[model samples]
Target: MSEIPSTDEALANLSMPLLDAMMTQRAIRRVKPDPVDDAIVVKCIELALRAPTGSNGQNWEFIVVKDQRVKDQLGKRYRQPWSIYGALGRRQAANDASMLKILKAVEWQVEHFSEIPVLVIPCLRGGTRVPYVPTPFVGETSYFGSIYPSVQNLLLAARAMGLGASLITMPLWNVTSARKILGLPLSVTPICVVPLGWPRGRYGPTTRKPVQEVVHLDQYGNRGLTP
Candidate 1:
């Protein structure tokens, strides 16, 4: 009979490649001219499918967009809100150089989304009928809990394969038109659209709120163990 290894032993045997991949992942917007092959995209989709779902329902679907005409239409539709977002970001910048730099990157993304090699739409199987206000209980399982983890897994897998991707939701905000263009059924709702390609830049460390400020103890507001 096979024996199980200790937790420490398992930790010691962890794959360094995967660890590096996880540590180095970043949301890259600018990409190279080299196109991602369809076979590779399919492999990434296969990896995304392996993500666990609530009750193992696996009700996630991926729509790959490669046609330039479709991309152009999406870009045109997306620009309306993108312009508003850019204006808001500029106002928030307040002439701060660093903030302006960040906004510039965002602006570049908005302008060139259609030029990206591949656009992937992650869709949920069922629709939710809830009011604007929060509800006591919605359903057996929430769509976010089932599908978002899969999207994260997809991005991580893409990083490991030397590809880069970013999650974009501006297009999905126009849910009606977006669904019509993609031929998505009424039951299926688009969650996020990811643009994928070979990155033009290198990955960098991510900044976040300190662990001490975020983590909580037994109570909701109580600070957790000190770092």
Candidate 2:
């Protein structure tokens, strides 16, 4: 019989892959034909469920779209905002070269969204209608604070499992059509759609503004703490 790995060895092996996953995550729109099995999909959801929720409510739900017909319907609805967004970007790009590149990349993503293998919808257990009256910022933050963590956890878990996914909200702007197509109840509001599948290529390290530039001391604009 093969020798079993010691506990420390097993933990060390697991840590390397987790670190690699965190370092390599990217918003991958293009995917290969390799199908993600139902079991793996379920496992990812299980991992997401472990995420902390407000008051331990665990009020998040996930809808997995595998049917081609439903995917096609979503793809059509997705085109509406995408077109408007593209137009706006094009208008702005005339004055800014960086804007031109960003818009072009977004256009490419929209064109291929429907071809993804699985579309995962993250839904929250709250009515869509928001009160017109002013509400405390804390209340608004508290409400969403419950579910967004779960969403991020799900994406990270997907990356660790060798699957690539991207969070998209273009279709959500047309809430009425999206609700109708998904048969979402009045109490449920769709937050985002994550397209997931095996990636076509390896993701490189993501670049962002250095922490020193963004992080401040006790007060805003205090740059003394910056390294």
Candidate 3:
């Protein structure tokens, strides 16, 4: 991890109590148009590989994209879902201004998604793994356990390297069309489309529900840790 790249913030974080990268990790959607070096992307992937995958099988791939024409195609497909989900969010969160703010941010993201420097489509290789007998077939939800853990890693790694990134699964909601646009083989499942760049604003801690509110210890509704 020391060999992986770092931002000044990450370097100063060496003395912080918590993992500074994790403590300040934000879902960055708005980003500058600066080009990301290819080596940096590989370094991020290296950190991502540290995450555990199901059955110790590393049957995953990150398709890094930068071609403007291709990004335009993918971004076009990504917008349909954004519109649908945005409408639903507007209806459901109508009374809440904060929720409406999130919808507006998402709208900005979809509109300028392709403008981000890099688009990484995290993938999972579908079907058999040869001699490796995989976990029993489960529902779609069950199967995603292998890829998303690394997705989290990738996000943190990008942040540590001073790159802004966000997980955008809306594009994958229309997997067939997305795969076609990416020229992916049918067996290669595009799980999510992540837009990466240098953030337009400063990096900071995320506002989230306290851990005690979400965690249960030994019994349901029992909060153990004090935040």
Candidate 4:
């Protein structure tokens, strides 16, 4: 295990090159239970605020959870859905080593979730005046479109600071229950949960398909300039 850095050392790591951080960022599920500095957690959210929102509405809220009881409640929510999904996943990936590896990591995370140090829940607060009212498709897009960019920013910041973090929505499967658990008003929608702590493993380069394989020129299926 890597030695835990002083808060100053961890904050200074934010100067790491953006490309390096982006390329190496991955869902780090396993982490130590050591308490993270309040300043470090705040800094990650501060950077997250830099991301763009739909119409610049900035209708975002972040709930930083450190309480063990709250974490246990969220863990229960996670397990409720995962029990069924995990069984399905194992059966589906029975013959695929790569997929089985990913499932195993998720299993570990689900089992140890409450023991993780922090849970940052990002939320959205504005849209329809009436809560839970159905909106048109475009309205729907604009409504939920606001939170993801900020989430990417948060993930990138976590990567720069060498914090282990992963974005998961499973714990939020039951919105009504989640709202009650977090004491959120109906206007605020909890988008996803980001679990954070010092890593049990290290961050490294990720494998992905070549850009050319997925990129198209001008329109779909138009491989312009490709010989």
Candidate 5:
């Protein structure tokens, strides 16, 4: 196991390579309304480019929206599925104690998504999907696999720079309308919308199930040591 920080100061100044970033990243749903600098956005995109892409076909684009009117319009579309998902999470929270915190956070994000400082929509050029098995699910999942590493890289970079970011894909349920708002061509697919800014609170440790539950040895039944 990785060593825990000795104090809050150590945790606050914490920065490391890839694995430590993965260990500390939390979904920062609420962000201050102050706009992020254009230079920072460019830096984040540059870091994203370093991520490995399937077949090295680096086919991606980012649309950064800071205009209030456009944000309002996109937020309107985002709220549809955000509302539905929040309702489901709320209902589940009544019976599942573990879900209560995130349910409330989702509600807050839905209410203030438009007011968040910056909105980033990541897109993929349509024809470059990595080939996968012919099954429909495989095809879709494979397409996303190619794009998400870059998304994650951007988020991790944001955290490393003390910025907050949350990857929201719920808005894509009405993909046609979203594509129209972004003026994306029919061949371009917007993979996810990311909201980013300075966070209202500090980030610290994150919780997860024991590693043994997910990791296994050479064979399927060979669960590693019970942690």
Candidate 6:
């Protein structure tokens, strides 16, 4: 979509087939700095509410950030880590075309971070660890695992609405700083940030390895169905 979609238009767009949305939903890091409709954003989060959470805890919170000052803070944090990692990634991907493409896109996002229209910070309320107590492996997994499904739903909804979006965590590398910047209390742990805007590029089918290559049959080493 070349222009910012109307609320009604965006809502109507959400009926896109599940498989179609999944197939084309690549991380869209390059986006225009246009205002997105609040209704659309809420609808996406509403659909996200449908995803199951661990133990039905549903302890998820979505912080929609549009303030430039807040984005600038997050952007500063993002650049801090990206300065080192981005250099390393560039060197590692020097001979890889596909990887270089992704790196370039990321570089654009880092540079224009403050301009992106909306950022959705998915957070979890409650802690797996008590003071002086060690959280078990399952406790850690269940805690973080609770919010990702909803994040996936949010991403798919963005795709269906033709809104460019990408999931990122580097911006929140310093949890304390992120919490302070977003005014988040200790009980709420921000999982990741999903920056949303209208696409500067178009969404199309993504490249991936064939299913057989990654799918193991019954055992860890069994690559095919006929193990």
Best by lDDT: 6
Question: Over 4 Å off in model 6, which ranges?
Answer: none
Query: What would the TM-scores of all predictions be?
Result: 0.84, 0.84, 0.83, 0.95, 0.85, 0.97
lDDT of each residue in 97-216, candidate 4, tens digit only: 988998998999999999999999999996554557766788878877899899999999999998999999999999999999999998899999999999999998988887788889
Clashing pairs in 1: none
Tell me, by TM-score, which candidate is best.
6
Candidate 4 backbone overlaps, count: 0
Give lDDT tens digits, candidate 3, residues 1-227.
02323445544433444388888887888887777777777777887898998788888988999999888888788788777778899999999998898788778888987788898888998754445666556735555888899999888887767777888788777778888888999789888877888787667877898777888888888877565
Give candidate 6's total backbone clashes: 0
Compose the digit string of candidate 2's lDDT tens values, residues 151-187. 7777777776666677888877887888898999878
Q: Encode model 1's per-residue lDDT on 107-143: one tens digit a residue.
A: 7777887788898888988755665855445453475
**Residue-wise lDDT of candidate 5 within 1-227, one digit each (tens)?**
12222233333443556676788799988777876777777777888888877678787888988989878888888788776777777876787776888877777888898889888888888753455835567666766777899999889878777677888887777889888888999888999988887787765678998788888788877896565
Q: What is the lDDT of candidate 4?
A: 0.93
Winner on lDDT between 2 and 3 is 3
In candidate 6, position 39 carries an lDDT of 94
> Which regions of candidate 1 are displaced past 4 Å?
1-16, 95-98, 130-141
lDDT of each: 0.76, 0.75, 0.79, 0.93, 0.78, 0.95
Candidate 6 residues 98-124, lDDT tens each?
A: 999999999999999999999999999
Candidate 5 pairs with clashing backbones: none
State the lDDT at 202 in candidate 2. Answer: 55
Model 1's lDDT to the true fold?
0.76
Residue ranges of candidate 3 with Cα displaced over 4 Å: 1-18, 128-142, 223-227
